[model samples]
Target: MTVTSAPETYPETYSAGAYWGARKESPEDCARRTAGFLNLLAECDPFLSHWYTPARSRRDARKHPLMPPDVATLAELFRRGMNREPGGPAIEELGFRFSFDNGGATGDCATLRINGGMSSEAVPNHCVLNVPWRGPNADRLLTAAVLTKAVRAMVLSWEPDWALAGSSAYKMQYPEPDSAPFSLGWITYLSRRIGTVPPLPAPVRIEPVEDRGTLIILTPERFTVANPEHVALARRVRELLVQAGLMQ
Candidate 1:
């Protein structure tokens, strides 16, 4: 495993706040719940073998840009994704000990994410798919069909009764985690750690937010534009949002 720089080191312990819902799962309890969910996933697909959450991945996800950006919007996304509202002791984020696979035991996959969050964000339902640059299945996992099936099974694991939402679109990213500089090499995680320059323009969602200038984000999926100029792109973003049913 190549060294990864802290793209953005979020506080080790998040403060208590209803801002991004609550983190109530004790580490041990959380682990137990994760195990149960993985077993449930096994029933969905025999190839859905071997699942465990990676501590580093969970820590990284905590800093996800869209995380509780605005509680109201986030809650709305959550309701749509989970078919239930946020708050309560349900779950905030589901990082099943990094058990994101359903393509046999070869570890041929990159990332396996489900909409465990209370919010599904802008892409119908949110998904984060990563294809490691140097994995055994690197060549075979390069098609949409493989990814779609994985995404579908993920939904089933958590919401077996709910009809899958956003079947046509799946949020995906091909991140070379081991040696990649996420955010356009500005953070230089790989460089600082090892002597690798992550290929760029990095996979990040960028758009101009009204007059807020251009905002660059590494969303779970959708919009991977890098360093867009605000004056030149905000108007376009609004129009795109409407077309995508994200805005009025």
Candidate 2:
């Protein structure tokens, strides 16, 4: 019920027409891009998540029969193409149209609580992005927020059955206790686990258990690479949003 960090956007639901288009990529091309992303992620940091190579190998090598990676080939129908319809939901005050499909979330200063269908892996989905932001990055935040929706759609397009991809969540705590993390973050693919749910990546330690369940947390001060490639991924993600017309 209580949220850790972020602002306020009340729950408002509306139907949306698909805003995504389609793009076609050859299998070899998909592999090259997957491999490229793996390399880019490594460039963002050194110690790899043990899950990276295996996931890429299976998806890129054209192994996963069900997994047709729509990572970069995200057409208009590619990801969160839901709100582009003529009668799509719009933020009247701000004059920006948005749609809520997966589910809702509450944002606090440093933490987030993903609600309903968005937090269920069994539902066949992708990781919901819940980044915290402030005044200076308002535009960035708006675009990033929309970007989050599409990215999840993108992730699901690739590995819709990712073990914990759509199922779990991470929350950041402020006024962090001696045991709790001062902040939290995860790599893009880290949420796109290929097979069974794996253990938490390096730099991430289990904080004290909550009444609900044990949380996958990151205490950046101690864990150097809690999110080795988030910055890089964020930049690229923005690019994707712009190209997809979710921004501007």
Candidate 3:
């Protein structure tokens, strides 16, 4: 008798992010990084090209175009977004927080959230990109290849300790270890500050992200937790990474 395999389940949404421990920076510094990141992201995909500052209304949002990012404008936006205590003054330790998005239909759009300029070693500064579940371009843009570019863009622009791109479900299944620089994903970027990436078994490819560090591609196709093969491979790779001192 012939049997049919169960359908695979995948997360409805995916996200990419870069993270690093506290590093003190000014609004200008954060703006510079933000501008550079957006430019890199635009080159990664057409869907990621346009962005707008968050505002009370769509009309107001369009008044400020985040793309072709103006360093001066971004610096002003970051300054306005500074963490303040009630009505007292800007809290230096809390850092600057800002969010923007590529305006479009629900599924077609994406949000970029940023938190930087912190001085506390305990807090992590990050740039996160969130993509929706379904959309007109979803079929084409949501592939492992595109997501890998997104992660690479983040790594190149931020030069964070680590960066990752994949479904939220996969990340939930394999949360990042406190001592590890980053969690595995469809594409994971590790800074040299973390350590060298050791070789792994087949289908897993590793490439350099300039002089920054390495990019590990788990699979050329979609990686889903529902697939035992995918999960097993990720676990195995994680084990090897830890053994190689890339993770703890």
Candidate 4:
């Protein structure tokens, strides 16, 4: 007889995302945006610098470098990523999607998934950045200031309707109701199209992201659900934001 134990699973990692509605664009257009985003992301942290193209296997994927983003290579990648009906033609109304990751240590690796160039209102376009949790640099890299900049970079590159950066665990536990237009995070960005950001409580600061949108920071440190005070503050701020017509 033999006994085996499952590998220990770590806590949910943090993520940064930008979401937006339909915007008709070409493969080239999406490539340009992706290139800009990768360049901007590299400046956010050393852990997010090196990136590789996707392949049949991680080992194969690592053979290709995606940094110094080439517009032609990215454009072809998006073209190949176009949404297609099962055994049918490409879905024109849908969009393209591609993923890449920094190839390295588990603790330092980061992933980027992008869906864009959609022309259908029903199909949302988004860019998501998955952060590492157990790596040596995770603690130092996961800060309010750093995540805030990461979120702002998303806004600048994607011009999304909204953007958020925070812990996946906290978001799941304190999931915003369906009535709320968007979820609250350690850092949230609301485009001007949504509405003006109202004055919020102390420790909660608001800043403009150029003329595009407003950036809301809940705390100056890492927000953890383990802290009751952190949870409480987030709820209060969310309430105010909803009342101000920012979330609705």
Candidate 5:
């Protein structure tokens, strides 16, 4: 296979691995560090302002059992880690690797890869999260959450009777887009929902297909379409963004 190397001109953004490498501190310390980083991000990049909203409360968090508190902590860490150098904690602990790679002749830019998975091809310009799960109620709930977050675009792929264990199942794929920062946020957010937080590998491979394109390879279990509710949830998320003025 003709391996097309990554491109150049990507921008440097923080990654979970980078945060892990910074230092080791108590969870509270980490929280403070994260909050600081987010504040700094707001000052530097105007686009990230949308993500600066108040964090979900513990009760609210419990409602989404799949979402771990660490995800929120990591998000905060990203906000702070970017503002200052790696200190107070190690980036490795945070579960991300932030590096810059060229997207071939495109330009020199940064790419964020997970768990040494296919190196981040390039900062995504846009991102769409598709949740395919069984049952209409759960799917609607997930869709409501996605919409509340104001995702720009989304795809909800649904399948019924996925588990085959006399029950339904669901999966989601957040397609990469051109919106770099927002795309990262979307990944972080969805991962938390699926109980796949940072420091976890992408569970798939992103291989360069041809030109500047890529093909994501997923296992059978992960690819199965078992749930329709999640798919519907993703659709509502797209609508929510339009109503919130976050998407075009």
Candidate 6:
């Protein structure tokens, strides 16, 4: 995919504190949980093994923008997993080894390490999806759906709560001047792709307080669904987990 530059008129309103505070999952926790979630996805979908990797780039590291600390940590974890090292005690049961890297870009880069190379010709999933708002918003949404569908088809079939990070509406509160508009576009795109628009909570109001923005947290809905065709597969997996008594 071609990388698009950020808009010249992109507003600058991102506040690090506001964005972090609004997150239900801390960055570290999100990395670990995402790894595990993706592992579950791998069991259900065949495309996952094609999209993950454990390679690292030490050359010209300084040329790339500073990677998000969390992303970097996760990338390191994946590298370790590839070498068959313990790699942080398997934070979750899904056997997911995920880490992120900065790569000096606004969008985060992620790496997933898989054991015993599943496919001979499969390349690593190294593409980073940025969230800038310049392209046709619909295209942005379609791209997000492709990513999500790939994730669901290859990793886990479950959905998680998502928030729009860089919209003008959100920037009014947590002004992340460098944040990508990809996530926001993903939500809009995915809603249409699934052919079902889940009811969204009312937009939260942001009040300015002491030169900082205060967020009014809104309840988010779950995006999980079960279709009849997958009923047997889901039931079998549930039964195996129950028999193993591995509920955590």
Candidate 5 local lDDT, 94-134, one digit each (tens)? 33322212121122121222121111233211212122233
Clashing pairs in 1: 52-97, 52-98, 53-97, 53-98, 54-97, 54-98, 77-119, 77-120, 78-118, 78-119
Better of 4 and 6 by lDDT: 4
Q: What is the C-alpha lDDT of each candidate?
A: 0.30, 0.27, 0.85, 0.87, 0.27, 0.29
Residue 10, candidate 2: alpha-carbon lDDT: 35
Best by lDDT: 4
Q: Indicate the residue-level lDDT of 145 in model 4.
A: 79
Per-residue lDDT for 184-224 in model 6, tens only?
21122221111222233243222222222112222122111
The best candidate in terms of TM-score = 4
lDDT by residue (1-248, candidate 3, tens digit) is 99999999654577889998888899999999888888888887888898998988878888887879998999988889888989799889878999988877766778999999988777689999988668666776778888888888888777799898887887886787676667888788888898999988989999998899899998888777878899999999999998998776
RMSD of 5: 20.0
Q: lDDT at 28 for candidate 3?
A: 93
Error of 3 at 233 (Å): 1.0
Please, what is the TM-score per model?
A: 0.28, 0.20, 0.91, 0.93, 0.21, 0.24
Higher-lDDT candidate among 3 and 4? 4
Give the Cα RMSD of candidate 2. 19.6
Q: Write the per-residue lDDT of candidate 2 for residues 221-245, one digit (tens) a residue.
A: 3112234453343334434434544
Candidate 2 CA-lDDT value: 0.27
Off by over 4 Å in 4: 1-10
- Model 3 residue 144 lDDT score: 80
Lowest summed lDDT window (length 10), candidate 2: 12-21
* Rank order (by TM-score, best first): 4, 3, 1, 6, 5, 2
Model 5 scores worst on lDDT over the 10 consecutive residues at 157-166
How many clashes (backbone N, Cα, C below 3 Å) per candidate?
10, 16, 0, 1, 59, 22
